[model samples]
Target: MKARSKSKSKSSILFILCVIAIFSLAFTGFKGFKIAGWEIKSIGEAITKGLDLQGGVSVLMEIQEDDVPSDVRQRTKQLLELRVNKIGVSETVVTEEGEKRIRVDIPGAYNSSEIVDGLSKTGNLEFKDSEGNIVLTGKDVKEATAVLDSTSSPVVSLELNEEGQTKFAEATANNIGKTISISMDDEVVSQPVVQNAITDGKAVINGMSSMEEATKLSGIISSGALPVTVKAVSVKNVGAQLGAEALPNAVKAGVIGISLVFIFMILYYRLPGLFASIALTLYITLVLIVFVEMKAALTLPGIAAFLLTIGMAVDANVLIFERIREELSIGIPIKSAIKKGFENAMSSIVDSNSTTFIAALILYFMGSGAVKGFAVTLMIGIILSLFTALIVTKILINLAVDMGLLKSLGQFRVKRGAENA
Candidate 1:
């Protein structure tokens, strides 16, 4: 009996520590406490905002058909989308406007001219030696990555294909100690001196100011080339004034709705409801963390999806609590009742959440813009809700019971009587 008591005491301490850790992580994400002298942004600030929330540049381009096939136009559009996404722009929209025109919408971009210049360029990478002789092209490149050099300076490392290996080896051998100019769209992006003949197809371009510049160059080089040239026929600047006005109202509604949910859970299920509320708080924090980590863009529809998942999170707790009540009404012991409750609730919870996840997956693949954002956020929220409801809530309730804080079925609003037995 003494050993059992000691074990229970240890379990109680462990439970308390887990709760504290959860709260600390949640608080850090929500309030963003600083360490040392560096400032960390809160989860809200870390998440990328959509075009509707933050204004950016939109451009419509006409694909010039100088003997270019229709398939080339489509390929060009796809390549442009890849390039834009590579630049770290979240929730950017690239859609075919017509048979020959493509539309590009980039969020969080303030400079229209800079974006236009980047998007309009063909991004064809080439290496030229002195006397203006072309040594290698992007097609000969196998891969490109940004890395830190020996001095901790940013540089782009390149891997060339078989043909490129031969050509580069010959070029470097013939032009040792000479400068080779690397050009993108016929403009010199980098010039590096050839130290030796590179026979292994591996090379590095140094002298980048920052990692950002090196990464940009690497991404452009790795994205391949557009099959056809695109000319920007129209450019428009989108303003975020309307979205800014709507943000406060959206936040107010969300807060009010979630407050009502908390109150309902606490009042309806009593003890179990309180535990569920805490788990739901953790759920919200986890979802936001996922959004930030994924670099997902949050739009108006995405916010709606997040709110809807809160209700689903509560629903999961309600199901489990109802099962526990049923078991208690049958005069089962509290510990056995909790175990049976989760066991009975598992099938229903899995079925519902699985179906919802499937729907979200389909929407994500087929939808565009705001609809895609909504689907992505909904899927993430649903997964996190399941984790908190099924795992976190059960752990907390069991810990409370094991600690002797909850001993009677009466605490869960179930009376133990002869009739129940």
Candidate 2:
């Protein structure tokens, strides 16, 4: 009797702890707080909005192939993405359009002309001496970053590879007082006189008016040269007003859909359904927390994917509940039926969720823009749904049985003809 009493005590404590954790996550997700000088953002602030939901510039560029191979065009597109990202633009979309076209969408950017100019260049960085003798090129550069000089002025730091280091050292040693002009796309961006030979593979270019200019220059140099040229053929601007209009309706539909699911589950399955509903609520909260933490961009399709997974979450619970009911009708006790139901339903749940997860994984890798966002959210929701259904629901059901809230098989509403003898 004492051992049984102790076991129940432990179970009760675990049940309380689980409730506390769920509530804590919900509070943080809905209403963020600050602690120890660190601020945690609410889910609304944490999730990044995409171009369709926020105002941005979209440009369609046609590659000037000029006998360039298809592989080089693909590589140029990738490099362009890197340059865009390096400029501190988050949630930017760079994707291929057709065989020779590329599309770029930068959200929350007001100056489309500046962005277009920045992206149009081939970004071929070159260092030449006073007499116009080439010394080092972007291919020899290992990395570049923007930093402050000793006098607090903004400057760009360059780190070179072995070959660049050798060539640069020789150039600086030969031209101690002469200016080495650093140019991008045949335009001189910076011209600095070498005070001494730099043998450590590191150098700094100082002429930037501000940190922003230095950052842009560093980003361009780091992005490397494009394999082929591209010219903007079309440019479109998406307004934030459209996104603002669509957001509320999408959220309303999601809420109404989820509420309906909750009502259906409760009316049909009674006690088990109520437990499933609670677990599902926890699952949604956890999924949002994950999205915020991952800094994932939420698009319109992502919201749809989230709602779809909510239905799938309840489906798993229904399968387990029906299995439990079947076991109860066959003369099994409530506790044994609950355990057996989960054990028997595990395989089916795993098979279904795994296949869905694989599909989402494929889409994420192969798709771009909105499709990738949908795949990301779907993958997250599926994983969290499985967790809540298998782990959280099981724990809650066991706790209810242990607390004597669930006693007889009749509580599960077993059919008259199938009742245990």
Candidate 3:
């Protein structure tokens, strides 16, 4: 029993720890579970999808402002979708209506009129001169967009007309240390310093709260370049006062499904069952984290897709563990069995998931609304499952056994007729 060199054990443990960290940071402790002070997670956070599951209200909005162009309404609709999200419930759906109208669906919410009012008004984009003079206005500016610089600080950039550019350069050079006020729909957006003379028809507006804000301003500025006046012509004044009751049921179903899956895996697999259960738990945590981090909508169909992904993840584990048991029963040592089992079964795991992932891809492009939601979750689940089953679960079990965590060959339960035994 010569002691394993510290480096040998250290590297093995590190790889296992890497697998754990990916999921732990991903899941965020299932709301913060800890293992010896480190939070337990599995992958990057799983983003939640919207209903198609939770059920939300859909409202149609019409644009009537004479100032707005028909084509620009679509652009305005996209921008409004971003802005209305600030109220922050969960998932909000905004889509274009026939030319002069738009539709919005706020999940688990029937009341969003106030939000509608705020987004209905066209954004006001302006540029002030060295001495607060109205210089290049949004009308003269062609476009504005957020771009990351080498430093990665979010910058909102503007391009102006030749006439506007000349005026801008002159304003900037003369107004050094002065502020250029920017406003949208009469609301002040930014008052950044005139850092230098801009003779290149381009300007960077500094000073903003967040990248999110910068993105919004860029949209607003462009909204002004191509003005679109949208007024709510029709309001579906409905309240999901009824949906509040359904939210709890969605949660219950998710909990029950996961619990049953865990029990089944453990009952069939023995010690390896416990290992697979742990990995499956990690799988779920990551999926939810991705949802919250990405602001994905948690719809009912999306939840079903999530559960299906979980089962697939378990199947991958079962396949690999079964392969390992087969190897060990043939008189191979524990170390060789683990490695060979994983290596040989890798092909099968890949073949099965690849086809499923491609199907999800097709569904995502062809489907609309709820179908899209289901497609997205299925795609995400397949990717995460592959990582967990092929990499994370195998790494965990191998590390446990390598670190002398398993006491004997019996721990894996390899036997004759093991297929039915």
Candidate 4:
């Protein structure tokens, strides 16, 4: 029994340490390591931040009078999604707020005027014939990207699917010397003379006489044309300078919050408390790792969600510790009490965590902007709390007992009444 216990202790401690190290190294993107190829890039590095934390333009748009029915609004939402995707605004949020309004929130900073310029009008992607007849729509395009020639001439490179490709190739080929106009809504963007057959369903709008023009073209190509011009009724453009100012304060606040929880766990719970603390540290480290791995946006509001998770993690420890106290007061042996306490408290923990998780799910589905960020972090935090409280904390205690490493579980006494149970 003693030999098995020792081995189990070693294994448990080793697992915790390994989890921490692996997560740390992954987050660092192997910056200090010389491993295999792709050392500088990892799945963890791909996590993006939201506009509030990173600073970007937020433009609120209002719907206007239209002949289209309510069902058309649903179709409009899908097209808007396609348009946003085209622009490579990977962190963009576009959703219908009501029957007469839509909300679009995009992350990261932009040249204020440029974004406003692009957004000022409805995005309407259309390919016209020589006589200006509509030949293809945004749905026809398979993919789009920003491409540059050896001469550094930037263009919006596009590819169409089979049927659309055939139509596009024919359109460009037949209009050889004449102009094929590309327009958004009724505004003309490019009137390029067809230079060749473009049989591959590939072509460029030549009027992008400058890099800015090409970039806008790229954005438009990547983000399909908006179905309607969304007027910016309310606009706020946060500068990068503001982000620099706020980051340090945010970091300090987070440090303080986590530190308080860490210290309180160690001071109150005794032997189990120490184990909980270690698990807590690992819990936090893994939360960040999960954030990076999942590419969850870290926004200012997202930070609040993370902090709330810290509290939840602490709460799990509190419950378990209280349960252990209850068993102790009832005259159970320390070893038996530990096991019984964990087993008894588990149902309550599960119930509490599950309810919170459901709330997160609802918030994520129904809320947009910062609320979504908060919801995601809350869900992730609740999950991590459950793991640390049940599996991690229990493992640490069992390992210590098996090692016969500690003199007593007596030192875990705080003068708090047994009623804390």
The true-versus-predicted C-alpha distance at residue 262 of model 2, in Å, is 2.3
Q: Which residue pairs show collisions in model 2? A: none
- The list of candidate 4 runs beyond 4 A from truth reads 1-46, 62-102, 120-182, 190-204, 221-229, 406-409, 414-421
**Which residue runs does candidate 1 get wrong by more than 4 Å?**
58-103, 109-225, 229-237, 416-421
Query: What's the number of clashes in each of the models?
Result: 0, 0, 32, 11
Write one digit per residue (lDDT tens) for candidate 4, span 231-266.
667677877778766766787899898888777877
Candidate order by lDDT, decreasing, is 2, 1, 4, 3
Q: Give the alpha-carbon lDDT of every model.
A: 0.83, 0.85, 0.70, 0.71
lDDT of 2 by residue, 1-421 (tens): 9987888788778777877888788888878989999998888777777777777888887888666677887888888888778877777778786577788888884567767777888888889999999999999999999999989999999999999999999999999988999988998888988888888899887888999778877888898888788888888887878878777888789889999999999888888788888898899999888887786777789999999899889889988999998888777777888899999999999899899999999998778667888999999999999999999999988997786666765568785423331
Better TM-score candidate (1, 2): 2
Candidate 3 residues 135-222, lDDT tens each? 7777778767777766788778888888888888888888888888876666666787777888989877666656766775675566
Q: TM-score for model 3? A: 0.60
- Winner on TM-score (2 vs 3): 2
Worst 10 residues of 2 by lDDT: 412-421
**What's the CA error at residue 33 for candidate 4, in Å?**
4.5
The parts of candidate 2 lying over 4 Å away from their true place are 1-6, 58-78, 91-105, 126-183, 187-215, 230-236, 408-410, 415-421
Instruction: Indicate the worst ten consecutive residues by lDDT in candidate 1.
Output: 412-421
